[model samples]
Every structure is written in structure tokens, then in C-alpha cells.
Target: MLKFVIPAVALAAAASTPVSALEVTKTATIAAAPDTVWKTIGAFCGIGDWHPVVEKCALSKKGDKEQRTLTLKGGGTLLEEEQARDDKAMSYTYTILEGPLPVSDYKSTIMVAKDGSGSKVTWSGNFKAKGAPDNKAQEAIGGVYEAGLKGLSEKAK
Candidate 1:
């Protein structure tokens, strides 16, 4: 994963006094098959409905693929560009094109695994920031991940 590195002064100007990169992982068990879960997770427009923190996602044209601009209830927008997509591999990667947190080179992948009676969904990402330190950003990102995962799990029921 490529880390988004932000310069200290610029980072402070962007968010607050401190900025740092964040790595987050969140997982949840869904009472659906991997394919069913994937259908929901990969649906760009339906994301906000399942992810509690996201109010909506605005999509724009980007050649053959699409671009996503996610508005979070926390007052920031996430701009992500799809880097790769493979239904056979059941994986896709996205890079943060722009964001308020001074996040750069932000990349993430969602992995699905069959677990007996259900499926496990994992959301993971890596990125860097410029203002504070790495740990703070990590915590914030973790919270985001947890909230999304929890919402998905609830909706999956």
C-alpha cells in the first residue's frame, strides 16, 4: 500500500494543528453469501444507505469507470478514484484523489471470506497525513472503519 505523506505545515493548514497518516481495518460477519455481500458493498450509490456515517456519495464520469465523492456526516468529503477492479478476484483498489485530511496515496481493498454459516467482510486502508502524528490518524481512520462495518452488519441482517 502506498502511504499518503503530507508536509507538516500544509497538513496543519488543511485540517488543524496536527495531521498524520492512518491505517484502518474493520471486519464484520454477514448472514449472506460472499456474492450477496459483494453486491451491496460494491454498489456505489447504495453505500451511504448501508454505511451509517456516509450521508451520500456523488459519482462523476471517469472514462470507462466511475469516480466517487463521498460526503461523511463528520463534515469532510472523501474523493476516491477507482484504481483496479476484478470480480473474479473479488477485489478492487482505490486511491484518494483528494480530501480535507491531507490524505495522499490513500489506497484500500475489501476482502471477503467464507466463514461457515456466514461471510466475513474486511475493509482495510493505508494512508499518511502531515500535521500531527501517525497514531492519531490511525485512530480516526479506525473509527470510520468500525462505524461502516457495524452499519453494514446491521443492514445485512
Candidate 2:
């Protein structure tokens, strides 16, 4: 009887939980070495150099964590904080502090790995849609990845 009661309470509590995150993942392959790709995108501020939509990136520090404010081409700013980075692993994770993307609680990671004579790149994120439909939010982040990967591929070549 006690086991039944506890299980019922747990299920009731879980049913009351709110919100779900929408996930997005995108991948690309570039004809560059993994280490070279990491060098191209390793720095927290290096995104401004390769991301097509990012006009410039200004970096600041919040204690030990690094933050970057990206200036978009048409006039918008995206502020992000570095969560963790691994140069040897060719990966970095970050969270959005503020941005135009239609997402809340946004977190993303980009990774690079060697594939034959080239590099494979991946960008992925999870967030709950804010003020927009879920599909719209997905499209926004997906478009950013597509453009960024395209730019990186061109630059790496």
C-alpha cells in the first residue's frame, strides 16, 4: 500500500511539470583538418570571422567565464556566455544570455572531428520556444547553423 501511494504521488507531480525543450541539430563537412577547423573556430571570439550573419564579436569576461556580444549584419546583438570549452576535444558549449533567436533557456554546442582528409562539424541546441511557434524557433536556429557552416566551409577551403 505504501509503495502504491508513493508511486501515485510521483506520477501526479510529474504530470504537473511544465514546458518542454525543442532540440535542433545540424552538421557539415569541410575539407579542413580537425585541428585546423578548431583553430578557425576555437576562440570564443572567432565566430565573427566565419559566421556569415555575425558582423563582429566583442568579448568580455564574467569572472572566469568568457562572454561575447555578436553584432549582426542588419543591426542586432546576441550576447552569449561560454559554459565550457575543450580545445583538445575540439568542442565548446555556450548559453544565450540575450538574442533575437526565438528561444528561451538556449544552450548550444559546436564540435569538430577529423573525417578522412577533412573535418566534420556539428551545431546543436535545446530550448523552449518563446513568443513564437516551435517550428519558427527551429527554423531560426537551423538557418543560423546552415549559414555558419556554409561560411566555415568556404573559409576553410
Candidate 3:
């Protein structure tokens, strides 16, 4: 009984511990409307068109899920899986399967909506830092989203 009780107490304590997740959000305003912006960036593999870092993108389907393999400009690759997409909402969500980014269990969403003067595009993600400080990981992902949004906004113009 003593052996089992000790293990049970330790397990309960471990279960009570808390874990924190890092998050980043970046938004941009495009000159076009939501429909036009969605047409430009709504596709699961469309990042190559608006993101400067993505040189090329190829999409594949395994079962019902869609996956995209992005070849980066300088010579790296990222694999992502599309979790959900809604054409009516002009939004899509995806998860990072494998990537060069210093993150793990990363899930992201990209959406376009109507702003006051133009359409707004938002890119946001939640993840856990992997092999890097939380701030460092956040900064890396934040920079990518910022650049991507900037490129998309300019391209839409």
C-alpha cells in the first residue's frame, strides 16, 4: 500500500503542474476586399504566391487531409498539414508537421476580413518552444508572420 500511495501522490502532483504555450499574432491591411484577398491567399498551398521566403510549394493529399511541402528560398523545406479551411469565412487553419522553425505542436490560422478601409489579414499561431527560449521562438514566428503579411499586403496592392 505504501508503494502505491507514494506513486499516486507523485502522479497527482505532476498532473497538477501547469504548462504554458506561446502565441503570436500579426495582421496586415490589404487594398482589396476580403473576397479578393481570400482568393489570393486562401488556398492551402498559396503561401508561395505571397510569402517571399517560400520559393515553391507542392501539395499532396493523404486520405482526407491535405499536406503542403514548401521549399524555402535558401534551401530549406517545411511540411504542414491542413486541418481545416472555410471558403465562406475566408479562413484556414493548419498545423506544422515538420519545419525549420524552433517550435513544436504548432497550430496556426490565417484569415482575411474586411477592415475599415480595406481587407485585413491576420496570421496567428500557438506553440511550445522547442530547443529555444520562449521569447526567441516567439520572435522567430512573429518575424515570419510579419514578413508574410507585409508581402501579401503588397502583392494584393
Candidate 4:
């Protein structure tokens, strides 16, 4: 009886704790130079230009934060706010304000760096699953990153 009670108590405590966030990261090597890669994707709304699924991007300002509303090809929209940006570092970070993604508290960063004679682009994100299992959410984000990186690579060439 004592052993069973202890195990049940532990299970209850664990169930009450919040779920940990999951992360997905994807990288690609581009034939272009770092500076040139940054110039191609540096703008806040440039995702529309290089992300294959993005159909349109509308930029707007809210207080000091720059926000972009991305209209996706199949008819979904994502509203994201720029959290941090540094052209010198060739990196920018953003958070989802509202979107159809299967994750919550989603924050992502994209960075470009010199790799040998070309550039390496990295895109990573952290978030908790929402209305879906962790693996599903991770897969969704991974697919998005993969598609975007592929598009970016093509544009850089």
C-alpha cells in the first residue's frame, strides 16, 4: 500500500508540471557570400521573397516592434513580431503573435555566417505543442524551416 501510494503521488506531481518546450533547427549552405545572403534576407518582410510557402508579406509597426503578417500559399496567415535584429551579426529573431502553427510561444531565429567561401544559414525555434503532440509540432516547424532554407538557397544562387 505504501509503495503504491508513493508512486501515485509522484505521478500526480509530474502531471501537474508544465510541459517542456521543444526545439527544431535546420541549416543549409548557400553558394553566396555571407554579406550577400544577409542582403537577400535581411529585411523584416523579406520572408515573402525567399520562403516558398509565403504568398505575401505585409509589414506594419506596433510601438517600436516591427511586425509582419505572412499570407501563406494555401490560405493561412501568420502574424509575427520582430524580437531582435542585427544586420552586423546577420541574424534576426522573431516570435509568433498569432498563427495556425501547432505550437505556442514560438520564437525563432535565422542567421547567416561565413562557411569557407560560401554562407551557412541556420534557422531554429523553440515552442510548446498546442492541440497536438510534441512530435507533430516539431515536424511542422521542421518542414517549414526546410522549405524556407531551400528557397533561400535557390534565391542566393
Candidate 5:
């Protein structure tokens, strides 16, 4: 009885570790040029057309600067503060300010590369869920991301 109890406790401890440290990445090839795709994606408050879950996005703040807020559908909002950007690198990172999502330290960048006559776009991020994000939470985030990329591909063309 003692042996079984010890092992069970150890297993539980390992399972309880916070599910924070997850990276979800998705990529696609767009028919349009990288500049065109970037223009559509980098547009603040214009994400509603691409992100399926984001019913609308309005600029909570304005400026060619860091830190901005975007309100989402279903009573959730996110704050993004820019980390870096370069036309040559085609990448940027932002931290989240507020939201219902489990992720805490969330930052992502979209990179573009010339693939033959088209452009290859890669979206990647690393974050840790506030607590433990169930499978449903993970799937929801992933689906939204994929939908956004697909929408960009279609609209950019």
C-alpha cells in the first residue's frame, strides 16, 4: 500500500506542473508578394477579416509605437506591445497584456521568405498557459491561428 501511494503522488506532482511553455507554429505559402501579405496582417483593428474568432478588432491605442490593445469577440481582449521589427527580417514580437486565454508570456513573430514566385509565411510563438490549458484550449488557439493564415492567403491573392 505504501509503495503504490508513493508512486501515485509522484506522478500527480509531475502532471500538475503548469502547462506554460508551449509553442504553436503554422506556415503557409501565399500567392501574393510578402509586402502585400504583411500589409494585410500588420494592419491593426483590421484582424476581424482574417481571424475567425476575432469578431472585431478596434485600436485601443494608436501610434507607430509599442503597446496596443485589441478587443476580441466573446468578451476577451489582448494587449500587444511590440518587441522588434525589421523590413529586412520580416519579424516582430509582442507581449500579451490581458485576456481569458491561459497563456501568460506570449510572443509571436511572422516571418516571410521568397519561395519561388510566391512568399512563404511562418507564424510562431512561445507562451505558457496561466495554469493548465486543457486540450480544448490548445485546439481553440491553434484553430484561430490557422484560420487567420488561411484568410490572409485568400485575401492577399
Candidate 6:
């Protein structure tokens, strides 16, 4: 009885602990058609052309699994893999396999949709804080999304 009680109490305490999961979504209105915007940014490795912080992108494939290695301007690399893509929907989903971000289990999607005569682009992600506070991790991801969206808008213009 004592052993069972102790184990149950520990399990309850652990269950009560909060998880550091976070999500971020950022959007931009680009003055271009959805297809045009998608064409500009939709390639798996095209981020290097539109993202200001990305210096280059190296793409690889292994048995139908597509991955990209992004080299940032300040000299860090992020390895990511494409999980899904829909050309008709103008969206793609990807996950970070390794990176210097302040989060782990990171998965993200970028989508473009018709908005009036232009297009609305959304970049969103979900992850858990790693080696950082929740707010700081959120802020970091938000900042990246904001910058990337701005760059995409400029390029799509």
C-alpha cells in the first residue's frame, strides 16, 4: 500500500507539471496573385532567395525524403525536412531535424491564399521551449517568421 501510494503521488505531481509547448503564426499581405507568390517562394530550397537571414540552401534527398540545410548569414546551419506539400493548395509543411533555434520538435507550415486581388501568406509553427524560457522561445520564432514574411513580400512584389 505504501509503495503504491508513493508511486501514485509521484505520477500525479508529474502530471500536474506544465508543458512548455508554444505556437506562433504570422501573416503578410503580398501584392501579388496567390500563384505568383507561391511560384516565388514555394520551392523546397527557395528560402535562400527570399529569406534575408538565409545565406544559402542545400537540398538533399534520401529514398523520397526531401531535406534542406539552411546556412544563415551569421554562420549557423539548420537542417529541415519536408513533410508534405500541396501545389494546388499553395502550401507546404516541414519539420526541423536539427537547428540552433530555442525550440525543439518544431514543425511549420507556410501557405498562400487568395485575398481580394492579392494574396495572404501565413507562416506558423508549433514547438516546445528548449534551453530557453517559453516567452523567449516564442519571441525568437515570431521574429523569424516576421522577417521571413517581410522578405517574401518584398520578393513577391
Ranking by lDDT: 4, 6, 2, 3, 1, 5
Q: List the candidate 3 regions with Cα displacement exceeding 4 Å.
A: 1-18
Q: Name model 6 segments beyond 4 Å from true.
A: 1-18
Per-candidate RMSD, Å: 9.1, 3.0, 5.8, 5.5, 7.3, 5.7
Deviating ranges (above 4 Å) for candidate 1:
1-22
How many residue pairs collide in each prediction? 8, 0, 0, 0, 4, 0
State the C-alpha lDDT per candidate. 0.74, 0.92, 0.91, 0.95, 0.72, 0.94
Q: Model 2, 70: alpha-carbon shift in Å?
A: 0.3
Clashing pairs in 5: 20-128, 20-129, 21-128, 102-130
Residues 9-117 of candidate 1 have per-residue lDDT tens digits of 5666778632444578888888988777777777555567788978889888688766789898869898777777777666677777877664555788876678788
lDDT of 2 by residue, 1-157 (tens): 9999999999998888655878899999999888888888859999999999999999999999999999999999999999999988999999999988889999999999988999999999998899899999999999999999999888885
Give all TM-scores, in the order shown: 0.76, 0.88, 0.87, 0.88, 0.72, 0.87
Candidate 6 RMSD to the correct structure = 5.7
Relative to the true structure, candidate 3 reaches a TM of: 0.87
RMSD of 2: 3.0
User: Measured by TM-score, how close is model 1 to the native structure?
Assistant: 0.76
How many clashing residue pairs, candidate 6? Answer: 0
Q: What is candidate 6's CA lDDT for residue 75?
A: 86
